[model samples]
Target: MSSLFGILSAAGQSLLTFQRGINSTNKNIANVSTEGYNREIPVFQDLPRSGVFMNKIIRVFDQSLFSRSIDLNQKLNSDNEFASGLSNIETIFNDALGTGFSSDLNTFFNSINDMLIKPDDLAARSQFLANAQTLVGKIRNTDKALEDLKQQTVLKVRDQINQINQITSQLAKLNQSIKTKTLDIEVNNEYLNERDRLIKQLSDLIDTKVVFNEDNTVNVFTAKGYGLVVGIESTQLSFETDSNGNAVVKWNNVADITKEIQNGQVGGNLKTIDKVNEQLNKLNDFVTVLTTVFNKVHRQGYGLDGSTNTDFFTIDPSKSGTKIDASNVYINITDPKKVALASDPKYLNSDNTNGKNLLGLKNNISNLYTNPSQPVLTPTEEANLKASLNDPTNYDFIKTHTFAEFYNTKLVAEVSSTSSYIKQQQQNNKYLYDAITEKMKSITGVNMDEELINLTKLQRSYEASARIITVTDELMQTILGLIK
Candidate 1:
C-alpha cells in the first residue's frame, strides 16, 4: 500500500509538471513574433524519494545560459546602434559631394577667371561682381545648412535622453515587481523576459555594462562608468544650450555625461556638426579676406579717365562679421563709355599719350583675378593705407604694393585641404558602418524556421505529459474500485 501511495504521488507530480510545460510552450508560441523576445524553456529535476525512489518534479531555468544570452543580446544592440549612427553620418556628407558648397565655389572662381580677360569691359566687370555676390550667397546658404544640422543633432541627443529615461523608469518598476512577486519559476520567467527587453532598449542608446544584483534587480551603467539605472531609480539626463550657444548634455544635473555617451547616434551627429562648423569658419575667413583685399586695391586707383578724388569701389568696414554680406560693397563703374583715361581730372596731366597709370590700373585689376593675393595687411600697413587714403600721400604705391601673394595662396590651400579631409572621413564612416551592421545581423537577428521547430517540439512535449497524467488518473480509478 505504501509503494502504491508513492506511485500515486509521483503520478500527481508529473501531472502538475506537464501543466507547467504546456503553459511555457504556449508562452513561447505567443511571443515568437515579438521583438527582443528570447525563447524560454522549463528545466526539470527529480526530487530524492524516501527509501531509494524519486518523488517530486522540479523545473527551473538554466541560469548560467540565460545570463550569458542576456549579455550577448546587450552587446548586439549596442553594435547595431553604433552602425546606424555611422550610416546616417555617411549619408549627410555623401549627399554633400555633388551639389555642395565646394562645387558652387569652383564655379564662382571659374566665372571670375572668365571676367579677367576683358577687364576694361563694363559688362564683364558687372558679371564678375554678380558672380562674386553669388559666391557669397552660396557661402551663406552652406553656413545655414551647417547650422541646421547642428540644431538637428541637439534635438537627436534630447530624443535619445528621453528614451533612456523611459527605459530606466520601466526597469525600476520591473525591479519592484520582481521583488514583491513570489518566485514561482513561471512568474520569474515572465519578469526575466520583460527585463531583457528593457535592457536591449537601453543598450541601443549607449554601450553599457549590466550587473545582476542579489535581489534579482539589474544595475546598468555606461561602458565609460556613468550610471543609468540602479535598483528602484534611474539617473535622468537633460540637454540645453549654454551661454556660449553650445549644446550641453548633463545627467542628474550634477554629472557631465557627454563623454560617456560615445559611439552612439548622438555622438556621431555631434561629430558631424563640429566638422561642418569648422568648414564654415574656414570659408567665412576666406570671404572676409577676399572682400578686404579687393576693397583695399579698388580704393587707391583713380576712376577711369583718372578723377583724383573719385573711388572705384565703396566697402563698409563693419561687414566683417563671421558671415559675409555682399550688399555692404559696390563696384561703381557702371558706364562703359566713361572708362577712358580722360574721364577724370586726375588723368588730365597724367601721361595721356602713354596711358601708363591707366594700363597699370587695368593690369593690377587683372592680376587680382589671376594671381589672387592674400589680404596680409599688418596693423602698421593698414594704418599707413588708412592715413594715405585720408590724407593723400603716394596713394598709387600703397594700393598696388600692399597686397601679400603668399598669404592668399596658403588660405586657399587650407580650405581646399579641409574640404577634402571631410569627404574622406565620410567615406570611411560608410565602410565601417556597413561592416558592423552585417556582423550584428548575423548575431541578433531572428531565425523564423528555428523558432517554428522549437515551438512544435515544445507542444509535443506538453501533450505527451498531459497523456501521462490522464493514464495515471484512469489507473487510480481502477485501483479504487478494487479496494471498494
Candidate 2:
C-alpha cells in the first residue's frame, strides 16, 4: 500500500509540473509582443527520487544569460545618448551659417572705399552712412541669434534634468516593489528584466553604472562617480537658473555637480554650454575692439563740409564703460545738414600739403583682419588725432585714411570665420550621430518577425504541456476506479 501511495504521489507531482510548464509557456506567448519584455523559460529540476520514483518539480532561470541581456541594454543606452548630443550640436551650428554678418561687413567697407574716391560728392557720403547702418544691423542680428541659441540650450538642459529626476524616482519605487514581492524564480526574473529596462532608459539621460546587490536591489551611479541610488531609494537631481538665465544642475542645493554626471546627455549639454560661452566671449571682445577703434577714428575725423567739433558716428557711452551691447551701437551722423564733401582737394595727400589729416586710417581698416602684425593705436596717438581734428592743422595728411575700411575688414573676417566654424562643427557632429544611431538600432531594435516566431513556439509548447496534464489526470481517474 505504501509503495502504491508513493507511485500515486509521484504521478500527482508530474501532473502539477506539466501544469506549471503550460502556464509558463502561455505567459511567454502573451508577452511576446510587449516592449522591453524578454522571453522567459521555465527550468525544471527533479526532486530526490525514493525507490526510483520522481516526487517534485523545481523551476529555475539561467541567471548568467539574464545578466548578459542587462549588459546589452546598457550599451544600447550609451549609444543613444551619444547620437542625440551629436544631432543637437549639428542643428545649432547649421543655423549659424546664415547669419549674413560677414557679407554686411564687406559691403560696409566697400562703400567707404567708394566715398574715399569721391569725397566731394554728398551722395557718396550718404551711401557710406547707409552701409554703416546696414553693418550695425548685421552685428545686432548675429548677437541676438547666438544669445537665442544659448538660451535654447539652457532650456533643453533643464528639461532633461527634470526627466532624470522622474526616471530615478520611478526606478526607486520599482526596486521597492520588487523586493517586497518575494516572487518565485520566474517572477523574480521578470522583475529583473523590468529593472534592467528602466536602467537603460536612465542611462540615455546620463551615463550610469548599475550594481546589483545580493538582496535583489540595484544601486546606480553616474559614470563620473556620483551615487544615484542607495539600497531601494534614489537621489534626486534638479536644475537651477542663475541671474544670467543660465541653467545649472544641482543636487540637494549644492551646485557644481556637473562633473559627476559625465559621458551622457547631461555631459554633452554641459560641454556645449562651455563651448558657447567661449564663443560668446570671443565675439564680445571682437565687438568691443571694433566699436572702440571706430569711435576713436570717427571722433578724430571732421565732416566732409568741415563742420565744428562733433563725432561722425555716435557711440553709446554706456557700451564703452562696461558691457558692450552690440545691438545698441549706432552711427551718430544724425545731422544731414552737417554732411559735406572734404573741403580741400589736398585732403587726399599723404603729406601736410593736403588739408585732410586722415593718415593711416584707410590702411588700418583694410589691414584690420589681414595684417595681424599691424600695431594697435596708442593712447597718445589717439589723443593727438583728437587735438589735430579740433585744431585743423593738416587736412592733407588725413585724406589718405578713413573710418570705413578699418572697421569693415575686421568685422567681416570675424563674422565669416565664426559662421563657417560653427557650420562645420554642426555637420561633423551630425555625421557622428547618424553613424552611432545606426549601430544602436542594429543592437537594440526589436524584430517583429522573430517575436512572432517565438510566440508561435510558446503557443505550441503550452498546448503540448496542457495535453500532458490532461492525460495524467485521466490516468489518475482510471487508476482510482480500478483500485475501488
Cα RMSD (angstroms) for every candidate in the order listed? 8.3, 8.2
Worst 10 residues of 2 by lDDT: 348-357
Question: Model 2 over residues 407-481: C-alpha lDDT tens digits?
Answer: 333334434454465456546545655565444433433345654665565456545545654665677777789
Residue range 1-484, candidate 1, lDDT tens digits: 5555665566566556656655665666676566655555556566544111222223223445444444444444433443443344333333246323344445544553443354355575456556655655555555555566567766776787788889888998898888786646567656876887787667656557788887778888776767778888788777777663446678787777665555445555555445545544443444444444444444434444444434334444555433232234433445432332232344443323212332332224223332246333556665654453322322333355421221223223444454455456545655555455444433433355654675576467556645655776677778888999
lDDT of 2 at 381: 51
lDDT at residue 364 of model 1 (Cα atoms)? 43
TM-score of 2: 0.69
Clashes of each: 5, 14
Model 1's alpha-carbon lDDT is 0.52
Q: What is the lDDT of residue 421 in candidate 1?
A: 59
Cα lDDT of model 2 overall? 0.55
